[model samples]
Structure formats: structure tokens, C-alpha cells
Target: MSPLRPEELQALLHAAVDDLRPAPDGYERIRAGIDRRRRWRVPAYAAGGAVLAALAALAFFAISPRSHTEVVEPASPVTGQLGSGALAPTASRTASPPVIGPALSPSLSSKGGPTGATATGSATPSTPAPAGSPTVTPTRRAENSSPATVAKDGDIDGDGVVDPDISYNGTALVVTLSHNHQTRAVTLAGVVTPLHYTVTDLDDDGRGEILVEVSGAGGVTTYDVVRLQPDGSLRALSKGPLPLVVGASSSSGAGFSCSGGLVQVRSGTSDDGTTYQVTTTSWRLSGVTFAPVGKATTTSYDTTSSAADPFTARCGTL
Candidate 1:
């Protein structure tokens, strides 16, 4: 372990410097590689930023709520009418109420006029008007005595006798009895035109019932049934629209017929603009009202394509 002098240390350092070597293009090559890497990284970062922005916009729209509007309609009243003499109320006579005495039971007077009947079912016979003293007349009799046009005859009150007669007063249809001379006015509550009328003793009682055919706007047809009361008022037999056959489309129509005291209704409508459906329903009298007794059938046929569908369905025992 001998220590060298200062001159020896200086010569050793000079020798280490002479042993080192340098590459010619070291700095220039490093600078060119860094520039190439930066060019590729800039495009990749730009593309990544664009993708993130698009995802944010799509999520915003997906979570937003949409707006909607709805429409509502008012409830309609129930009323109906029947056209032609075909519609009738046909129930068994067993359903009829007991035979109350005729609605207008009057005793005969000397002049063949009405003799007042008492509340106790007793009649007080009237003699001639005291030998026509002064010949006084009633003003009410003159004003309301415009002879009514008898439209039909029926036992509107179900009183075992068809003593009620229908007539057309200037304002409405009037039902009157000959004995009491009381009048009942009939009107279609929600209907527009009372087009036609007919009467039939469907119940086989001595009294008849009235069926009126009415037409509303948009070619809507309906039927109404009215019963005359002994108390001088008319009552609706059908409290609502009695659907014989309801039209569902502009080109559709309904028809009804009666046979053997049974009513048959036939209707047709286009179901989806491509298929047409026809329905038939049969009804019978139950007690004071009509009920669907037999089977109802609906048959559908395709109109757009050939022979793809001609289906039939039994709508249960309606």
C-alpha cells in the first residue's frame, strides 16, 4: 500500500480521459425520437376527449322525461227508441199485474157524458144539466179541445185494457183515455227527431205499448218505449238506450226484425280497416222488459287479403 505523489495522480486522470470515446449523432437522434412520440400522443389524446364528450351528451338525453297529453269526454245519458211495428214487449201473462178495474170507470149520465166516480169506487150518476139552463160552457174545454190526431192505440199503463190512445198535439205526443179525458205527454229526453211510431200487444194483454223510432245527428238511430199512466203521465219503459244493433263505423248499419214475439238484431262493422265483423243478437221478453235469451254470434272476414281469415265466434250465451 504505497501512496503516489501528485504528479502520478495527474497522469492517471489524463490517461482515463484519453481512454473515453464519443458517438457522432447522439443529441440529434434523441431530439428526433421525442418529436415523433409527441405527434402520435397528440392525436390519441384528442380522439379520447371526443369520445368522452359524446357519451355525456347521450346520457343526458336518456335520463330526461318526455311530455304527453290526454283527452277526456263527458258521460252520456241513457235513452233509446224502436222503429217499425216489429219491436214488441212479449212476456207471459203470468207476469201481468192483477186486473185492476178499467183506468177510467165512469157511470152513464142521461146525456151520455161522464158521471163522476167517488174515491170509494162508487159512481154518482149525473142527470141532464138542469134542462140546459143558460147553456154555460167551459173555456178550458174550448182551448184544449182541438181534436187530437190519434197516432196509435195501446194499453200504455199495462192495465189489461188498451184504453189509451196516442195523439199528436202541436207540441208533443199526447196519450189520452176516453173516460177520464186525462192526457199524458211523451217526449224523447235526449233524442232529436221522433221519426216514426208503432204499437203491438207483445204481452198478449188487452193493452198495447208504443215504440218510437228516433234519429239523431250523424245518422244515429235509436228506439224509445213509453207507457201511459192512469195518473195522466207518460213513463219510459227503457230508462236508457236499448241497443238493438249499434253502428260502429261510418259505413256500418244495423237492422232488426221480430218473429213469434222474439226480436233479432243484426249489425256489421269494419274492425281494423282490414277485417269486417257481423254480429247477430236475439232477444225475448222476460217480464216487463226485453232480455237477451239466445246465443250471439260474431263472424269476421278479412277484406285486404285473400281467404286468410273467415273466423266465427259464439259470444257465449248472451
Candidate 2:
């Protein structure tokens, strides 16, 4: 083989290139034809899709379960009437009446029957008394009915003695006796002013003494226990001053009285305070002096202060 020259090889390549044809724009042309076909069928494809969706919805509705709905109507006025097509309403029940009998007259009941009156006239009505008629009689109380005398002592003067002064109607009555040495009589009258006195056997000598409360001016009051001497004279066994003082204008004084050998003296104050109260229980025996054994003093004071009013000084036997 001989080595070919450069000119001969170049001529052979040019003749091969000239014999080959161009691709004739085949890929672009095929793409354009495909687009035109799709454009023509787009409406028909859309219509087919809509028909399929409609068929599926119809099938689902035909097979699905359904709920029942009831219709209610308004009640008619003739609902409870017989033969009505609607349901008959219940009827309201009523109660029966109570049994009774004929009333029996009073005159008819007098005859012999169960409702008749008894032979004792039980059915007869009672007659009432007339108005202003007296139903009860006025009782008569006894007059001049004197109180029974318990004990009595005589006092010649208006003193607080059972002998001379008598207590009647809460007042002491003084009795006076006049004698002609043969016959004696007495006159009694309420004492103008009653003075209280106490009698007691203070000395224990079997003889009782009288104690009287006396008040003077300037807050001075005295309790005098006087014993009746055998010589017809009165002697003071004990004398003491009062612990209370009353105003000069006030009608205040001490009162003494004795009963069963016990002596009590009461004193009043001028103002509204505790009235003087003195109680003597026991006494001492001396030749002439009679003293209180036990004495208690109680006083009432004014509302302003605790100061007690002047009262009788309480002292025992010396």
C-alpha cells in the first residue's frame, strides 16, 4: 500500500458529507402536531369528568340510610267527644254527696221515740231571770264585834300603859279613874298624842321597868328606862342619848313600847332616811340602874354620802 497524499484524503471526506441529507426539522414538527390534537379533545375530556362525578353522587344517595320525621298537629276542641278519630281524653271524676236525715222538732220529740224527751222533762228549755233582778242577798256583818283582849294593864295617866291607856283603832286611849273612897268609875278617850313606852324586867328583880324615847331640840334624843318605885315615884334606871338627829321643824321623835318584858324604841327621822331603829334584848341588874344587855343600831343615810344620821348611843351594862 502506498501512502495517500493530503489532497486525496480531503477530497474523499468532502464527498461523504455531501451525500448525507438534513433531519428535515422532524422533532419540532411532531411536537406541534401533538399540541393541536390535545387542544381539539379538551372540552370532551372535561364533559366526561363531570358525568362521572354526577353518577358517583347519585349512587351514594340511593344506598345511604334515612331518618324518619314525625309531624304533630294542634289538638281540636272536640277531642274528648265520643266517635272522634283522635284519641279520647280522660274524664275528670267528681266526689259523691254526704248522706243526711230530716231534723226533729222539739214538740215532736216529746212523744215516745228515740228522739223524744225523758219523763223528767229533759227537753224543756230553761227560762232566764229578768234583767236587774237580784240573784244573791247582801250579807250583814256583825256590829260592835270587839277584838278579843289578849292582856290588859292599867295606867292612870295617858302614858303607854295597859292600865291608863288603851289601844283602840291603832290609837292609845287614856283612861281616868275618879274615886270617892267607896265607889270608883273610869272614863276613856283617845290620847291626844300617843307616846310609846316599853316595859321589861331589866334588873331581874321580878319587877318590870318602862322605857320611853324622848326627843328635844338640837338633835338631842334620850332613851329613859324608868322603874316604878314602891314609893309611888318613877326613877330612871338607864339614860342614853340618841344617835340620830332630826331637823327642828320635822315632827320626829322616839317611841317606846314594851310587851312580855321586852322593850323596843322606834325613832323617826325628819327627812327621807331610815327611820331610827333600836332593839334591846337583855338588861343588867343594879341597885337602881337598869342597863341594856345587847343593843343593835341600824341607821339609813342620805343618798349623797355614807354618813349615818344621829341615832341612840347603844351601851351595855356597866
Candidate 3:
């Protein structure tokens, strides 16, 4: 009883109100007030959130850097270790620069000069020249002829000036000589369409003679013996007829033999059978002409025989 329990008093009041009916207008007014307050508070909260979002967006843009469109470059060819991992870089494969130096040729000083060469490698051909050197342009010759080729170079006439000897100029044998400071060239007479020639001393006079193989009128092959004349001209010593030396056999001595101061021609008056009876005739050159020297000799030979041949030897069908 001390303070009459507060709980007892509250229960009494709730019981009294429980039986009483509340006013319907009062409930309706309370509902309307609650609705108005809720509507206003919802709009205020939405507005505050929208402002904060806008401020955040402005701050982010101001602090961030501007974006740029970048360009990419193409990669170069890379060759190196492949299967290990990434590709390895390597040096460029471009060619090296050409070497600049002097080119040596026949008669040409190593300092870049003219040339002379043979296809048989007995001579040297042309090659690329060095810088600042005089260029020697090549010219094409006629199909029927060869270019002026140097066979030997020396004074044949003994006039002092070194002669540039061109043995065969495509069609003929020429000897260019310098006499008394005058230069002269003679294309040997009776010598035509020279194919090639050899320098030899046939007379043993201590002088060289040019033996040329020429094309004859009837397409027959002819040989010419060319000698340097006293008047600085070239003359054919064997203009009459080149020695006939064919059908040569070891069994029979040479059909034609050339010795010091003498030349011989042989023939077999055979009926074109074996065991040819060969006859040899001898002659000597006398002032650019051939003169008979010794008596004619006849000898029998078995063609299968071998002997020391003096010159190109031949007997009819031997």
C-alpha cells in the first residue's frame, strides 16, 4: 500500500478507457496530419541526396587528368630466340659496301691500266676498275673478224720505237713497224682471211716468221709464211704454195720436213693402198722464193710405223 503500485493505477485507467468509444473525426484528423508530415519529409530527403551526388561528380572531374587518344607504331622484323619466351632483337641484315681498289690486267699497272687477256687463261681478262682511273670502253668487232689482238710488242724493223705487234687482225696478218721515226703497217700480200698465226724462225736467220692459216678461194685451208721485208713491209715467203703435209704417219718419214736452210715435200704415188711408196722432194728459200736444193728421194714405209717427224708429214692415204 505504500505507494499504491503505479502498475495498479495504470491498469485501472486502461480499463476505464476500454469501454469508451473514441470520436471518428479525431482519428481522421490524426491520420491527415501524419500523411502531410510524411509527404514533406520524403521530398526534403530526396533533394538532399541529389545535391550531394552532384557535388561528388564535380569534385571527381576537377581532380582527374584529361584523357588523350594515343597512336601506336608498327613493329619491325625481329629474329632471335623464338621458343624461349618473347622474341629477341637482332642486327640489320643489309649488305656491306663494295671495296674500292685498283684492278690489275695484262699490260696494266696495278694502278688501273689497259689490258690483254686470252680465253685459255694464258692471259688476263678485264675486270671492274678502281675509282678515278681512266675508263677503257670496249668496242665490238665484226662477226667475221677478231678485235686487234696483240701477239708481241717489240721493234721488228729495229728502227728504235717499240712496235706493237698485231699478228692477226681478223682477216690478215699485219706488222706495224716504226722506221726513222715513221710508222708503217703492212698487211702481208697473198695472205687473206688469216684465222690465227704462230711466230717461228723457219730460216734460222735469227728472225721470227709468222705462219698463218688462211681461208682460200675454194674454201680450202692454206698456210702462209710471212716475213718482215727490208723496206718495212711484210712479204709472204711461201707465196707459191704452202707445204702440203697431210696423211703423216710414223711408219713413213715426214711427207714434208723443214730443217735449217731446207724444206722438203713428199708424196706416195700409191694406188691408194697400204705400203705406200713415198717420194720426198727438197727445196730452200731464196729471196722470198723456194728453190730446189737436193735430189728427190723415194722410200717405202708401213703407215703403222712411228718416227721423228720434221714437219707436218703426209702421204696419199698413208
Q: Which numbered prediction scores highest in TM-score against the true structure?
A: 3
Q: What digit string (tens of lDDT, one per residue) describes model 3 on residues 167-202?
A: 444444655442232333445454433234444334
Ten-residue region with minimum lDDT total, candidate 3: 105-114
lDDT of 2 by residue, 156-204 (tens): 1111111211122323222121110111122222211234333334433
Listed in order, each prediction's TM-score against the native is: 0.36, 0.24, 0.39
What lDDT does model 3 reach?
A: 0.42
Return the TM-score for candidate 1, rounded to 2 decimals. Answer: 0.36
> Which stretch of 10 consecutive residues in model 2 shows the poorest summed lDDT?
92-101
Note the Cα lDDT for every prediction shown.
0.41, 0.32, 0.42
Ranking by TM-score: 3, 1, 2
Model 1: how far is 199 from its true place, Å? 1.4
Question: Per-residue lDDT tens digits of candidate 1, residues 1-318?
Answer: 989989999999999898777787888899989998899998989999999989998997776543212221221111111222211122111121112111222111111101221111112122222332332111111212221111113334433222324544445666664334456686655432322444443333333445554444455555555544334466556622253333334346555554445556666677465567757676664445677757888866555667522221111001
lDDT for 155 (candidate 3): 20
Q: Where does candidate 1 stray beyond 4 Å?
A: 1-172, 178-181, 190-195, 229-233, 239-251, 271-276, 298-318
